[model samples]
Target: MRIGMMVDSYKPYISGITNYVEINKQFLEKAGHDVFVFTFGDLDYKDDETNVIRSPGLPLADSGFYLSMRYSRQAKKILQTMDIVHVHHPFLSGRLALRYCRPAGIPIVFTNHSRYDLYAQAYLPMMPEEVTLGMLQAYMPPFCKAMDLVIAPSAGMGRVLRELKVENEIEIIPNGVDLASFQNASPTPREKYGYKSDDILIVYAGRIALEKNIPFLINAFTGIAGAVPNAKLLIIGGGVQQYEEEIRDYVAGKDGAKRIRMTGRIPYDELPAHLSMCDIFATASVTEVHPLSVIEAMGAGLPVMGIESVGVGDTVQDGVTGYLATNDAPSFTAKLTRLCLDSELRKRMGRAAREASKVYSIERATQRMLEQYERLLREPGRRKDKLYFRLREILQRSLR
Candidate 1:
């Protein structure tokens, strides 16, 4: 099967969506399928992976996203040849899939991987909530209805779609994790990070942004730091320059500044080992669809403490895998205090977390995804090539 993964952007710029496309492509190709990534911008970026097709687009500031109304002529030509196309973003890539592939009867699948509503609230704060929500309500239902298959990475996100009035059937599939790496990882020595062997390390790993609720997380830690003498907070990952700077200044102004450490962005290959060095993984972000960082932290055998909202609420097993408290700092701090005090509890929950993370392994996730693809293809009503305009039939093509 030739599968096309359509996205608005791809690396040289790193993001959860880019990582998802890259990992899934490898798994599908390994399973004897030809997988191609169809994306915009980064046209001159050299990729170590094969079959990534890029079309030119106007770069949108430094957000790592590109704006384009349509795929390049060559991209459209190759995209229609796909047996099935999976779209990761709903706006740009989603519309293009319908325009280029729908006419050819190539089934298109869409996965909702972002908390776009919250993102709008974060980035476009000047806009009224009613208007943004109204826009979503008007656009989502029709666009989702147009797809052959629609996926939601978490049940919470599925509920969000329903709230947007999208009545289409939604499938829940987690983005897979490379579990073996974290499951068997060796910790980067604690001393190297200026921590004693017995010190308890709390971690928050993901882009530092307003939507992540970083200020509340920092304040929560500050409130409890005095109580937990041996505990330290480690923040990993980088994000919007302005927001990150704000986070730095906020942290600096807080008490017990030395207890908190921020290591901008680290190499992906080094993530597992670094994560393994921590005692707990914590996040305050409510804008996650399904957090790959949370799952990766689970793979490293760490208990988690997160807010009781959407994606984080769905992933953590509450008191069993870790605690889930209300979104406020006081509530979050009370739970963080408990985790810091109970070493035995952390160890027990960490075991359960590791076991729970197995289902999201790349191997199992790929197989589940492949099953969905195969089932869609086998449907008697599916149109594989009946409406397709074969490249061979278009002799006058630019042949670029």
Candidate 2:
């Protein structure tokens, strides 16, 4: 089958969505299927992968998103030849998929990846929450209904879409993780980072942005610092320039700042070894849509410590795989202290976490996704794609 991945951005702009498309594209190609990625701008940027189709667009600052209403003629010409197209971002890429592909009688699939409602609260604080929700309620349902299929990475995210009044059927598919490297990961020596073997290392990995509640996690760690002197924190990610600077400044002035290590942004491939060095994986963010970082940490044999919210709540089994605390610093701190003081509990939960993470492995996820794709194809009315490609082949031969 010929598959096309539609997104607002790609390459040099690394996010969970880009990673998803890139990895899945590789897997599908390995399975002997033709795959292409259709994206906006970055036309001047060189890609290290094949079949990454770029079209012109205006860059949206350094946020890694491009803005344009229509794709280039060449992109539109090739897009209509695909058997199916999957859209990641709902706003730009989603609408474009509908505009370009729907008229061509191509099937479209959309995945809700982030908590956009919470995102508005984080990025546009001056905007009223009710207004943002109202806009989403008006926009989401119809946008989703127009697609052939809608997917949510977690059941919690499915609920979020329903709350937005999208009554359409939502397929719950967890984001795929390349778990092979993580499963066999060897721990990097803590001594290399200036930590003793006895010290309890707690790590947070992902974008260090406002929505992630990085300051809340740091404050909670400071509280634990006095109670459990052996507990240390490792933050392993970076985000927007202003937000990253704000977090760095905040951590710099804190009383127990030295105990917390911030390793800006590291390559995704190195994450498993860094996570293997930690005892617990922690996140304070309430705005998560099936956090890949937490799942990846679990794959590295580390238990998670997260707040009781949608994506985090859905993934972590409180008191089983890891502890889930109310979205408050005091509550999160108490659990952190408990996990820190008790080495045996950490080991037990870590084991359970690793076992649970197996379900989200890339092999299983890609197979499930492919099943959905094949199901879409089996439906009638998609024969136009075949005829279009056949005629194109004939025309090329005639010109030759």
lDDT per residue (tens digit) for residues 265-284 in model 2: 88877888989999999999
TM-score of each model, in listed order: 0.96, 0.95
For model 2 the TM-score comes to 0.95
**Candidate 2 — which residues are off by over 4 angstroms?**
384-400
Tens digits of per-residue lDDT for model 1, 67-137: 99988888887887888999999899999999988777778899999988899999899999999999999
RMSD to native, candidate 2: 2.2
What do the candidate models score in CA lDDT, each in turn? 0.89, 0.90
Query: Ten residues in a row with the worst lDDT in model 2?
Result: 381-390
Task: Extract clashing residue pairs from model 2.
Answer: none
